[model samples]
Target: MSYTVALFRSILFWIAFFVMSSISSIGGVIALPISHRGTIFFVRIWAQAHRIFCRFLLGQTIVVEGEMPDIPVLYVFKHESAFETVEQPMLFKHPAVFAKEELFSIPVWGQAARFYGLIPVDRDGGGKAMRAMLGAAKAALAAGRPLVLFAEGTRVPHGEAPQLRPGFAGMYRLLGIPVIPVAVNSGLAFPPRRWVKWPGTITYRIGETIPAGLPREEAEARVRVAINALNPPEALLESN
Candidate 1:
């Protein structure tokens, strides 16, 4: 009976998700003729609903401990689950995110992201895409929108992280803004293992906002330190 109920709930959640997504898409289309800010507001609402839907689908909840920065600045979010990509903005006010270029080609969805100020990337270390990310960061800084980046270039497997990518260091160096280092235990909530189905809580640990004007290498190192302070490998298993 529990299994049957879970299946029924999943079906209900998916139906609602499709309906809400269509409404969000319609909101974007309606905003095409209006102000960009309107579109951003619409997108934010859509993103919140989407995250809520994710919780419903997987029986998960996100708890972001600690206060976010009050000033407009750069936000360094740990990339683990797909949640960061969709729900990061909900945690920041008018945040500008760096994303892979392929995401920008996802039909109407991509267009809405572009409208909401997503910066797409090439992913080959650094080139025009890197420059574009820096440029977007600068614009966000100038316009007082928070800039968010993933230190990991791609999603690392649960309980296994390789190393911080170079682009994260490069962007921190060029931006010259304070970095609010955030660590997420999304993998515990949604394990990275293949075909895993259990659901749990995702805890977001927002560490002390590190002053971001440090040298390129130092800034990157500082971000890593803050992330590690949240959870070590030993504690990760208990969370899972």
Candidate 2:
């Protein structure tokens, strides 16, 4: 698609997104007082609507490889763009995603996210923050919700692979659960911080599950490699 056409489509999609999110956020907050499940219904609706808008408005398609585990485990994803962030709700069944603490402070949306069981991480809060995150994670697991984390800490540009943030190993070690690493090329189609999105397929490549209890170094090494599998060869070389 031409740049102008793509830009137009992207603008339309964002307008729709804003309207949908506003309604969903309000609905989620109102539903929280009634029932937790009611809030989730709105969340799912918002996510599903975005998926539809992506396909029809932006001509973007999402494709996933490898089976998604049915059991609750730590799902580590390659963070490239906001696309995957929106995709998480539809991809996982009631996952408790680890999000930056700031996101949990976003008024109505933040309240709904907390109610939806997202764990907030304070990057500079040190041990106290880690302990709080772990407690929240444990509670989510006890409630049968799978843990979802973007181990890179922040979104890296497409094709660049960075080491997993320190907190990932800490969470893995303390949680004592298997890890499933997911790699996606969402940035190719949905570039971060950009208004124009191209029409293409975003692929999610699910790596083999790494069992829990491995030494921290070994586990992080394995995850780092797995989550970068989809990155271009030159990008991998650059990171190395």
Candidate 3:
């Protein structure tokens, strides 16, 4: 698609997405004081609706290449852009995400995130912060909710493979559950640091699950390879 047309569609999608987010945030806020489940229910609907808008308006559709586990597992996703983050709640049932603490500071959205059982990670804080995050994660695991995490910690541009962050290893050893590593090419369709949304399919390839009980370094290595399976092998070598 031409840049002009892509730009227009991207703008329209963003406007609709944010408007829906605001409306959903209101619903989440109202349900927050009453029922946490009700808040999550509204949020999931919002995420699905956003996907629909992207499908019809921006000509983008998500194609899942592998099956998502029926039971709760630690999900380590390749963070290429906001696309997966927007689709996450819709993809899993009542998933507990480890999002940056700063995201939980947003007005109504922040409050709703906390009530929805989203764990906050204080990146710059020391051991205390990690402990607090792990504590929250354990609670989520006990509740049987899938833990969604970005192994790279933040968005890495398309085609770049970064080493898995230190926290991922910590969680793997502590959580002691199967880890599902997901790779996505969302950045190609919805490129980061740009407004133009390309008309293409955003592929999410779920690699084989890595079982728990491995040493921290070994587990991290396996996850890094799994989540970057879609990337070139040279990229993986360079990242290491």
* Tens digit per residue, CA lDDT, model 1, 10-83: 56666876788677767876787787877787778877887787686768787878888646677777776676
Displacement of residue 178 (Cα, Å) in model 1 is 1.4
lDDT value for model 3: 0.87
Ranking by lDDT: 2, 3, 1
Candidate 1 global lDDT: 0.72
Show model 1 residue runs off by greater than 4 Å: 1-11, 55-57, 192-197, 234-240
Each candidate's number of clashing pairs is 0, 0, 0
Stretches of model 3 off by over 4 angstroms after superposition? none
Q: Can you give the TM-score per candidate against the true fold? A: 0.84, 0.98, 0.96
Q: Give candidate 3's error at residue 39 in angstroms.
A: 0.5
**Each model's Cα RMSD:** 3.6, 0.9, 1.2
For residue 135, what is the lDDT in candidate 2?
Answer: 97
lDDT of 1 at 214: 80
